[model samples]
Target: MNKPCFLLLCLVANGLFPVYAITPGQTEKENPMTINMSINQQTYEISLSDTAAAKAFVEQLPLTLNMEELNGNEKFADLAHSLPTRQSRPGALHAGDLMLYGHQTLVLFYETFQTSYSYTPIGKVIAPEGLKKAVGDKNIAVHFYRD
Candidate 1:
């Protein structure tokens, strides 16, 4: 079996899937963890991934970070602390990706492109359109919160 299938089997074998029931006509799953980012005075809701890095990041939420531009495609900032990470490069990247690079740097991609760099995927912007425009090259304060 493929890795994803095997992982799912492991989760089911260990009863790791959430016990919450999915009612009829309800397509959206409950997300107890969420992150809010205010960039360029606009708020964006982000759904966090189930990863150690993501959890560590949420613990220090409500932060105002001065995001620096990188390669004209993404903005990044160093975190106050490092998080657990597995180095695996993604085939492609899209706008609105919140990622942890080398366990220390927090990267937010506002442009879609490919990369060979390995990063821990944390979450994504709920609404991705206009994200690039909102996060221009200029350094801007990105406030993060649990709200």
Candidate 2:
């Protein structure tokens, strides 16, 4: 086997690597890393990305943050600790994108817009129609937890 493939096999065999399956009509609840994000009294399901940063973020779950509003588009808070990052510019951001900036800042976008700044993927909120109203135009306390 090629060296890279052999290493991957070894990692899998040692239970040091994870494998995911994509099935037809699979729901977010079926995803092992899915989490609930609560703003005010409304809850949104977040489908976490398959990345090291997402895994690290999940490890610190059941957290509450007083996220500060920024630029009339997003809310952000500094994590108590840092996570691993694989940053990239996602040119167009949707309303429910949850991303990590640098190694410590956790950002939640509530608007659709283009950007040149790079961020690490954390997750995306499902059905975020009421999100903006829940957050309002001020800093809000948000909670994240696993069901």
TM-score of each: 0.78, 0.79
Model 2, runs deviating above 4 Å: 1-32
Model 1 lowest lDDT segment of ten: 24-33
Cα lDDT tens digits for candidate 1, 106-143: 99999889998899988999898889899988887899
Worst 10 residues of 2 by lDDT: 24-33
Best by TM-score: 2
lDDT of each: 0.86, 0.92
* Clash counts for all predictions: 0, 0
Q: What pairs collide in candidate 1? A: none
Per-model RMSD to reference = 11.1, 9.5
Rate residue 125 of model 2 by lDDT: 94
lDDT for model 1 comes to 0.86
- TM-score, model 2 to reference: 0.79
